[model samples]
Target chain A: MGRVVIDVMPKPEILDPQGKAVVGALPRLGFTGFTGVRQGKRFELEVEGEVTDEVLAEARKAAETLLSNPVIEDVVSVRAADGAAGAGA
Target chain B: MGRVVIDVMPKPEILDPQGKAVVGALPRLGFTGFTGVRQGKRFELEVEGEVTDEVLAEARKAAETLLSNPVIEDVVSVRAADGAAGAGA
Candidate 1:
């Protein structure tokens, strides 16, 4: 099976409390250098075979219509998952 | 300012109800071509100046120590947001 990846992030003007919580916790955990944080969503869609253009288009449609709220979030990307989840790392 | 993006996903064996919900909703919305779905998290960390090596290291450290739950979640990627989030799209 192949997979498609979709990323969704809050619009710049939206206030992200979850991100704020993380930003607040970072300093206490002694991790610094970050001025702000925004939390979003990532989706992996499993398909029967290769992630064809048709598949990507469907994924994008799904991203736009079902996965993210257009008013508050933006669909950052809808790309194929190249390999295993940990492959790139 | 530059931003660092961090992606966190649940382990393969874990059950993702949100994803399941989406998969169930897809066909109902007339959007198909996906067999399954897994939903995770995306984080953007804003920093001043540049995304230096030091900053990446800190982001990675924060991702590992604070952003994810070790027993269930995996840090998928910690990358530099090259420009305005909509740039690559």
Candidate 2:
């Protein structure tokens, strides 16, 4: 089996209300020294079967199409599990 | 500045619709071997100033309180940047 991690974040320019709310509440929670906070999502995936380049590419396409919003977010990075090191299939 | 990464996941018992959908789409994406996929969120944070145990603790608390749902989700892990390595403030 292979693993894939997906990170989703709001576009830098867009105002992240949730992030802003979290940042604003930090000091009240007794945290000092930080002026701002941004929040995003991370997804961990375990793919069944042998890891291949084709599998990786397809997974990435699926992520881009349904997992994240290209306009407001970007796929920061994509990596295959250590066991699957072959170049794209 | 210090960096904090927060991993949020749905409770094992709770059905993760998003995760389920992704898992179902894997085979169509040409991946084999695994049968299930679970998805979660990751937040990358840059906190200003020196990193202390208190800062870390406070951050954790904030995540539990406002960032994650204690009922249907859990904070899988929390980590600080290399620069901040002090024990509790």
> Considering every candidate listed, which one attains the maximal TM-score?
1
Least accurate stretch of 10 residues (summed lDDT) in model 1 chain A? A80-89
Q: How large is the interface RMSD of each prediction?
A: 2.1, 10.7
Go through the candidates in order and give each one's C-alpha lDDT.
Answer: 0.88, 0.67
Best by DockQ: 1
The list of candidate 2 runs beyond 4 A from truth reads A50-53, A80-89, B24-34, B50-54, B81-89
How accurately is candidate 2 docked according to DockQ? 0.30
Superposed Cα deviation of residue A34, candidate 2 (Å): 3.1
Writing each residue's lDDT as its tens digit, candidate 1 over B1-89 gives 88999999988888889999999999999987789999999999988879998899999999988999878888989989866774434
Candidate 1 has a TM-score of: 0.93
Colliding residue pairs in candidate 1: none
**How many steric clashes between backbone atoms does each model show?**
0, 12
